[model samples]
Target: MTKTSAVFPQPAPGSKPTPRVYTDEQKSMIEELRQYALSLLLPETDSYHPNERRWIEEPECPARYMRAAKWKLDDGKRRIKGTIEWRREYKPDLISAEHVKIENDSGKILLNGFDYDGRPIITMRVGRQNTQPSERQILHLIFCLERAIDYMPEGQDSMLILVDYKSATLKSNPSISTALKVLHILQDHYVERLGRAIVTNLPMLLNFFFKGIGPFLDPVTREKMKFNPNLHELIPDEHLEVDFGGKFDYEFDPDSYWEQICRHAGVNADGSRFEPEWKRTQMPQQEQEESPKPVDSETSSTAPDLVADDDDVESSRAPSVQLPRASKPVSVKGGSSGKEGVEVIGEEEPNVLVASA
Candidate 1:
């Protein structure tokens, strides 16, 4: 199979870059929907919701909510409301950039380049992530997800999570209960924001872990989960890091991003309020657009040939914040942490994995 490049336009040497231009009609539609969503999120007559209050009011924020709703007025309004409610319950703002000290956890989480669809690619090395406290890690993950909101390309409301299972041992795999909880928060609270996922370097033992949770997922969400050793199946070479056979190497200094957050919020390490940098000029919401490279296409190449069968294990899914559903049950055994690295589900162990009641 051949590869197709993304449509991100490149600037030729000595040529000035082209500025992105939105038509007047396009701008009006975006602004109008954003304002409508705001009405639902924050009404004049009612007291303020915490989520509404804590939310960064960047202009693009509304555009993202609208895109998540596919631009349907009613649906968009409902989506925004749900997110606000979820934020209040989850209290993501409290996690802030400082709480997640990432000096040792870089292997656990990272935001990489964009995929073919222009969605930011976030890779999770599960083996690497398992070292941290589950709840802390989950909180940081949510915080990063929110942080990505500021950097997403236009028209993309979601991003991709690449769960890299390389070097995964029984001790390093995330506990079933903990993994389920993380998934629930993402699906139930975040909702409709996940674009897709690539579960790379899967070991056979954990196949049962994925299989056990498969029953809860709808076919559409499940279908989005692609199991492949090769990253090229979902993204182009230029967008990938050398670890996955791409041009660039994945290098993220967690503190650098955290400091960015600190600067944006205008707070010191102690978390007291101070004047922010962008505040001197325009608030972040009205500032210049992000300068991420475009996702160009290589249409002439053949499609990538996947080594693994898509049906062998359960697939990944996108965000779907807190939708109502009846209880569904399923079970699969996990590897033990002992010498053999196999975990047998004992009587004391959990037998059912049901995300919703």
Candidate 2:
């Protein structure tokens, strides 16, 4: 038997086996499962119409399915296996979930909380639930006015509409003052644009300027005046009969309306009386002498007497001290004449030693 090289061809070293391809039926099943998982995560909104439903529902369907479905192939085998391990690892952090829950709760509480005085903190509540505006709301309005005035079109006047249905309800609220201050600031800051305008339906404006008599029929005067109603009742076709187009509506007098408002409100139009200028009164000669004189530059230049008086007071207040005199040296009897010579004296008797020159 001729020993022909009967060598079985060894598989190529380090070569990866071909991956197994999923059958169409298996692939379809896996896709359906993935879609089911996605549906569980995101619920469909009921806002869509029948025709629009398909587009809205399937908008993120592909991405959702792709994220949800995960599979792995066994080493060089065509068998496809679904992974539940990844799903177990995909749990959302408990802390994150808790944080979201807490945030939502706190937001709800803040929106609905009341002060010690039983007043709502936030002003922008639905409907007439909270008619009175809070300090925050007033501040918000001020900021809005500033932005509006900055960007308003030229010649087209800007108007701020403050709609308050319940004037009587907010009568006792302290926030009313804050609201008024905001209005005053807006009016004063935009004085150049004063004619530009502020259109408000709040009965408080009429109450404030018209002496609180126009909105309701005056029981004492028996005068009936129209007032603001609900928004739904306001007809778009309706127009205010007053000729607001006129430059001066009442009597063609400049500042007529403002003057009238001030009059009705019992306020001085000139504001001089409200903030009067202080006047100086002439003092008696004796009183003037008694009062301390202010040291001006003229008085300071000729105050030599004052300077001499200060110097005398300083010298008198100083402690007394005796300084050694440098005028003369004491002469010692029979003292040494040479510079290097030394002399000794007894304690009891005066004795002197002299060096020969």
> Which is the leading candidate under lDDT?
1
Task: Output the TM-score of candidate 1.
Answer: 0.58
Candidate 1, poorest ten consecutive residues by summed lDDT: 332-341
Best by TM-score: 1
Locate the minimum summed-lDDT window of 10 residues in model 2: 334-343
* lDDT per residue (tens digit) for residues 150-241 in model 1: 44554555666777778766666655665566566665555545666567667887778876776666443454566653465445555566
**After TM-score superposition, what is the CA distance of residue 166 in candidate 2 from its true location, in Å?**
5.5
Which stretches of candidate 1 lie above 4 Å from their native place?
A: 1-80, 130-134, 251-357
Candidate 2 C-alpha lDDT tens digits along 23-78 = 67646554554444434342333221221223214332222223223322121011
Residue 24, candidate 1: alpha-carbon lDDT: 72
